[model samples]
Target: MTAITGTVYDSSGQPVEGVNIQWSSNEDPPVSSHERGSRTIDDGSYRLVLHRGSWDVHGTKDGTGTEVETVVLGADDAVVDLHFP
Candidate 1:
């Protein structure tokens, strides 16, 4: 397993708290891969643990935002900051 950490931000360069973060593996054939999610804290920081693999990560806030990224996690931890505009 691997751990991913990052902070969410808005277009105004301010930290966005309580945003929902969703991630799903992009494996071939789309088998029953593990999908995980988490929400940012008051400080706009979040951490999630998932199996080592490639994933498509997305962050949504207030139904009018978009922040997306692709990440590959290895045995070690990873960091991915999401910024919504």
Candidate 2:
């Protein structure tokens, strides 16, 4: 298992707070029974723990969102930032 941490930004390059960071994996599932979501706080930062595999990470607020693909190696953490239009 590894911890993935990052921030979300808007189109104007401002931090986005109170947004939901959702992630799903095709090659590996969650390491535990935890849900696959992390919400950004006032600083737009979030952390999610996932097993080693490829995942599709997404950020969403209201009805708009953006997604990116990332891979995590065994026992290594990752950082993936997302930007929305």
Candidate 3:
């Protein structure tokens, strides 16, 4: 498993809390969504442990809109930050 961590920010560059972070794998056998997501805490930080593969990470909030980022994880961990505009 690869560890992915990052923070979410709004258009004004402020940390956003309670943001839902989700990811979809690009592998041949897709991963289940049940274990592929996280929610940002008070500090806007979130982490996900995912199988090594290509993934599209998405961050969403009720009124803040959504942001997406693509990441390729191998043996090393990754850091992907999401910022909404």
Candidate 4:
């Protein structure tokens, strides 16, 4: 089990708020790779639990930009920093 942790920010270099994050598998349909889930927080940060597999992680603030990240993780903590414009 690995904890994918990261912080979210906007183009202005300010941390975003009320953002939505999702962690999914690298499959075509991309199943929910996070056991706890793909969600966001008020402080613009998120942590998703992932197993040993490839994942497609992304984040967005309603009405803001969206980011798509492809990561291959193993028995290590993955740090995925998110930024949007």
Question: Model 1 segments beyond 4 Å from truth?
Answer: 31-36
Question: What are the lDDT scores of the predictions, listed in order?
Answer: 0.80, 0.77, 0.85, 0.74
Q: Distance (Å) between predicted and true CA of 47, model 1?
A: 0.6
Candidate 2 TM-score, true structure as reference: 0.82
Lowest lDDT 10-residue stretch of candidate 3: 28-37
The lowest-lDDT stretch of 10 consecutive residues in candidate 2 is: 28-37
Q: Is candidate 3 or candidate 4 better by TM-score?
A: 3
Native-to-model Cα distance after best TM-score fit, residue 11 in candidate 2, in Å: 0.3
Residues 1-85, model 1: lDDT tens digits = 8899999988887888988888877777542343336899999899988888788777887785556788888788989999987
Residue range 1-85, candidate 2, lDDT tens digits: 7888888999988889988888776564443332336799999889887777767788889878866646555678888888896
Error of 1 at 40 (Å): 0.3
Clashes per prediction? 0, 0, 0, 0
Residue 30 miss distance in model 1 (angstroms)? 3.6
Q: Which stretches of candidate 4 lie over 4 Å from their true place?
A: 27-38
If the candidates were sorted by their TM-score against the true structure, best first, what order would they fall in?
3, 1, 2, 4
* CA-only RMSD, every prediction: 2.1, 2.7, 1.9, 3.0
In the predicted model 1, the residue pairs found to clash are none
Tens digits of lDDT, candidate 4, 1-85: 7888887888886777667776678866665554335555666778877777788787765666557788888889998888895
Is candidate 2 or 3 superior in lDDT?
3
